[model samples]
Target chain A: MSNITSQRSAPFVVAQIRQDFPILKLKVNDKPLIYLDNAASSQMPQQVIQRLVDYQTNEHANINRGVHYLSETATLRFEEARGKVQRFINAAETREIIFTSGCTESINLVMHGYGRKFIQAGDEIILTVLEHHSNIVPWQMLAEEKGAIIRVVPINDAGELLIDEYQKLFNPRTKFVAISHVSNSLGTVNPIREMIKFAHGHKVPVLVDGAQAVPHMSVDVQDLDCDFYAFSGHKLGGPTGIGILYGKASLLEAMQPFKGGGDMIAVVSFAKTTYNHIPHKFEAGTPPIAAAIGLGAAIDYLLQIGMVAIAEHEHQLLEYATAQITKLAGVTIIGRAKNKVAVISFVVADIHPHDVGTLLNLDGIAVRTGHHCTQPLMHRLGLSATSRASFAMYNTFAEVDALVAGIVAVQQVFAGSM
Target chain B: MSNYKDLYQEVILDHNKKPRNYGQIEKATHQAAGHNPLCGDHLQIALELNQDLICAIGFSGESCAICKASASMMTVAVKNKTRADAEALIQEFLALAKGQLNAIDLIQIGRLAVFAGISQLPTRVKCAILPWHTLHAALNSGAETSTEAEHDPMRTTIGGA
Candidate 1:
């Protein structure tokens, strides 16, 4: 129960929760800010910001190195943060959660740590058209190095993944599968649970790219039964440069250490080095300690409001935004999947997305324009790029109205050009 | 929204709708493609050079309105001009786009001055300068050029090109 749904059942409320994000009050170009680019990066709440300030003010220390009191406090808080992440995603163990720079590095970790060790030549790695470049490129690099083939799962015209086709892709050659829990560009909520089960049947492990899914809905990695789960913090209203990789403990133990450095080794000498445990073995350097703590605070903030509440509000916004945009002439909604999050990708006829983005900025309505790093999906949809408006828990119905008004103003500016 | 009109203006939109010299120039002496990787804006500039003069110029590709309009105006402005004059114009237009233009440079930009507002939109400076980069690349016989400021060969070899 996030704040929105909590309003229906209990004392917590969405309006009070909205005040937690100070950027909501910002005025861009003399107009009230209407931020719909949450899918790219959501606005950080003051709670997370204050947590960073407090941590740096009181407990700033390099973790696990010193015998000092501050080092012990920082180390305790950092491990507590890891525990928070473990519980947030319903991870099986604390050691299963490895912190990286972001979701990209998390996937790359698997590509290096797991894929390199086990995957051999002639193996086929299954991917979907809905994957971001972050998910695709690392696998491509791994495939190139290992002489593996990448098999793709296509999407229908409505931008929904073809589940039947995905099932058909598996054979003895299929070694692994990586699919997005949600499509960033189209807002399509993929059936990852079923897909993971299908992969498991083939004895192939599945890695769900939860970068776009975790913020909008409750994610239970154990329930999905995915071998690995990855997500970014910034997209979850936390600080940038921090993300999580949830791997099955056994799988993590079996894989090679992705990087070797301080705090990641049990014993280190020039002669031979024995690596540390699961999480630390992958975290090579002095990780983003502050960001991981902020992400913990962000998780607290979301849990306080409740995810069900957040998803409910986002769905309402999606419905209103979709209905309004559909009524406009020459404006096409790109993704109309039966199941989707609050993202809306659309194109204004004969006008490039850059033009639309520029005009919307003048109206203080910020939406992401271009391929959204899912160029292959854009190509599959027969578009070079489309403007996207994504919602977060803090977003309001008025903000959706502002977005519509902004689009109308953009249309008026280029009225007869088409 | 008026801020957009200042950037998009009536003429820029018209040029985008029906770009002048909007095709490959047959028997072109030199040609080069330009790309703004940030937004996937791409276009090629082709010119038929007769000794030192650009006899005919044309451009073709897929890009945003700003890039299409900039390319359209560039072909119109540089067609039939001497090689030196065209190169000078390219520098002036690029300077104008980056908002580094002096009053003299602004005047030199002429009708192309409509794109001057791009400097305020840092994300769009490349869109306005892409055509100029491609034109410069075409004259110098480069295979391609990017809108990235560091890749400007003219900045290092202005007179040589």
Candidate 2:
């Protein structure tokens, strides 16, 4: 495996990696597809796709509480996938990894299972402004139901969180802290390890939303010492409708189940019922079997490539793209944080981002254009929406050139009309 | 997908760059704000009605070239026309933009003929029609049409009255 960080002299062979993804061969609007919408959903490689196909073909069975041949095999594979996820995130144990539908459901599970039980009236929950609506709305619902207060950590002009204000928000009433490991809209990589340390000192457990972070860089739940970490598999080149929520074993044992079903209960009767242990307690029903296995395959694929290499390549791409886009006459790049992922959001000479997205699509460059499920963040930045181009390990520098050319064409269309 | 040139024609861009009647009308008879939460396109339409005929009309907002140009052309097209005539023209223009109407006389549309290119870009039809919807809301005295319940094809309707 190539380590782009340590072996800085060697160039990342993006063309070789692009070959692994069959979708890269597709064309849209008579042009080669330049997928810059990885932040929205990354494309799956052949390995994960094949894994899903293999699961459906030979090993199709409902897992847990099965005695038949295929059923036992499916259960073993599902448990093996959980172990893979445990190793992927450096979790303490496989029992700490609970599979949910996606990042939204994972967060909602925490809110309902833990939050509804522990959080009390007038208790303060600390959150950051750059959170996706998924993270914010669930907590807001909790706060509303419990009569709890929610305090936000503001961001500077460059979209980095104000660490000084975040610490000040901590007090006796502070019960929890939920922050994103990376901003999906702005691409700011928040210092989670340090933030978690601060929250731990105040005895407040923190939940790191790692949906955007897990795909870009290596994430270790044990290293961060976060109480919980949530991420979606689809954003990491795995199948959709599957996600992982890594919680501390002690915390998972204490929290109530988010839902009740056949699998999550050890024993059920008319009057008395006992819940299952740790992970099984959280995952209620027959989960997305193929997607979990596919996510395991995705983890294997990512490990083979090495995350440090992906991060380094994506960083170079971001640098190259930022340099190129900054040179454009009317383009203004948003979120200039010192530490960022491979996402770039920008505006062009007061042009609406929708127009930019539409024009980019003509060149077969797919970029996201909207508030990006971060409405409050958009309001904080004084922007209604922005055109965002996010990169993955498979993206080439040539695709960045295509994006710039597409943007220039958009400007020319406006200028020539004048 | 539609060709980029057809959606962003020279006329549309020209109007976008230098939109006519693109300011607030002071002491207007009726005014309303419109927003497209889908794209965050927001516009405010103010109308000065002289009995049933529109005396003066102006708009202000931050939106796409299609929307701005459409608003600019709408104000010019509807000014001095009676409320009934303006409503009729708006229906024809929207139908033409949606590609439902094959052909319409340019004379009837006036300068609004530039919006015929909207038929090509289905996704952008909202940008072309948002201004007219805002105007409709303003003229009808708080009659707002919410698009939240509509199906996928009509999901991009202008939000708020």
Candidate 3:
């Protein structure tokens, strides 16, 4: 409520923005859709959709290898998309951006390419309790393989990381730190810049999982000085099967290539094979060209709307939703971190989150239920699961009201049954 | 909403609120665990078998209404039936839930027919059938404990049974 006036002044024209996403008009169970599962994946705007169609219809071809006209056009557009991503995150150079399948693959690439090469037995890698399985499992796999120990930074009940404990986790054997910029499960936005700076003080290279961060805020890789950053395209209003991993030039040069394929090598012979340069060295096969371009277009759309305005609008929505939901009896909101994005995870008294989700779906309100791929986090929080309503830029205040009503209806259904 | 009414029928709701045979069976001869990865539902089913017949059955776990209700009705449906008959009932129940077997098949299942509407909820079909699956595993393996694989319901093809 304090920042409500300023937030309203921000250039967030929700009605106009909602018109761009065709899927928002969809009806579910004979009711108007109120999609609040943005944390899972944001809906694509018509501009990005058209860009994808335009790419496929006219500019489609296998990039990097062909000398044909379509191939050249595709290659140029794909690389330009890389440059767009370069500026979107404000990375040092375009060469730092490596395209992969999604955030999961991006992390796996780092774990294999960098962790296998640099980390030694008995070395420690620091991670946090807020990590998604994509961030945790890859490191666990590497730790098991290399006999490395993983030190986890625990969280408070509010779901904020313990900075003091994080500082203590570092020692001479600590070679790497992998952390998320935001918690996808609880919407807790971590103090990534401070964490990255602290890790740097210990000479530990840090990898920031921006899958949940990039779509919500303006992130400058150079400003954070993170050694590596990764995010998924689908979560950023683009198509799936596309993601980017940004690593410093020095780090990329030192690490081995993740996947060996046709496009990854500069020269290949029966006797020997020479690998290609930085970005192409990681992008092994024919990449998702249309998705890459679509992501670039998505970036363009976000830029036009302005990240500051988007953040402000979503913050307002989060505040509004939190206040409204908090007023309801028997509803417990999880993860009350002071700094959070627009996600709200809550459990209704004596009701299973699965039932809540199913019942809410009947009201045409979509939410995510379950542990949200953060089983360890859920275990740490002493919750088996939660129903999460996450907001995006196009989501309206009225939609939040719809969600509250949906919850009330769900409660009625459960209460009456009892 | 009406479509959902078919899934969360009155019988299912009543059973969920006060599930039958809801506690552990300490002297059970067979036992198995069922897990729904999507919703984080955990159920452990134990059966006391006298010869080939299910003499006593109990389950203990935290699960959704669909799962709890399905387990409540399933224990009642298969109790005192021979292992072979129980297995047949399990198959028939799953077939009915997946819409493979029509409502006409419910005559054989008795009160368990309340779960026939489960065919409408493709996602919750797993919740309805998890107990039956656990029972099948317990009766077949003869092991002290059997566990289902962690399945992503979103990726699972409905009626794939």
- Indicate which candidate wins on DockQ: 2
Alpha carbon lDDT at B84, candidate 2: 91
- The CAPRI category of model 2 is medium
CA error at residue B149 for candidate 3, angstroms: 3.0
lDDT for each residue of candidate 1 in A192-220, tens digit (9 for 90 to 100): 98898889988999999999998989888
Question: A39 in model 3: Cα distance from truth in Å?
Answer: 0.6
What DockQ results for candidate 2? 0.58
TM-score of each: 0.95, 0.93, 0.95
Quote the RMSD, in angstroms, for model 3.
Answer: 3.5
Give the per-residue lDDT digits (tens) of candidate 3, residues B1-161: 37456557574457878888999876788888877666777888899889898999998898888889888988888888899999888878878888788766455687676677778777778888878778887886533221235342222357332
Native contacts recovered by model 2 = 0.60
DockQ of candidate 3 against the true complex: 0.57
Listed in order, the DockQ scores are 0.48, 0.58, 0.57
Off by over 4 Å in 1: A1-12, A416-418, B1-4, B24-27, B103-107, B148-161
DockQ of 1: 0.48
Which 10 consecutive residues of model 3 chain A have the lowest summed lDDT?
Answer: A1-10
True contacts kept of 3: 0.53
Q: Native-contact recovery for every candidate? A: 0.43, 0.60, 0.53
TM-score of 1: 0.95
Which residue pairs come into collision in candidate 1? A1-A306, A2-A305, A2-A306, A2-A309, A3-A305, A5-A309
Kindly list the per-residue Cα lDDT of model 2 for residues B1-161, writing each as its tens digit.
56346647655556877899999887699887777776778888898998898999999988888888888888989999999988888788777777777555544785566567677666778778878777777888654432342522334442222
Q: Per-model C-alpha lDDT, please?
A: 0.87, 0.87, 0.88
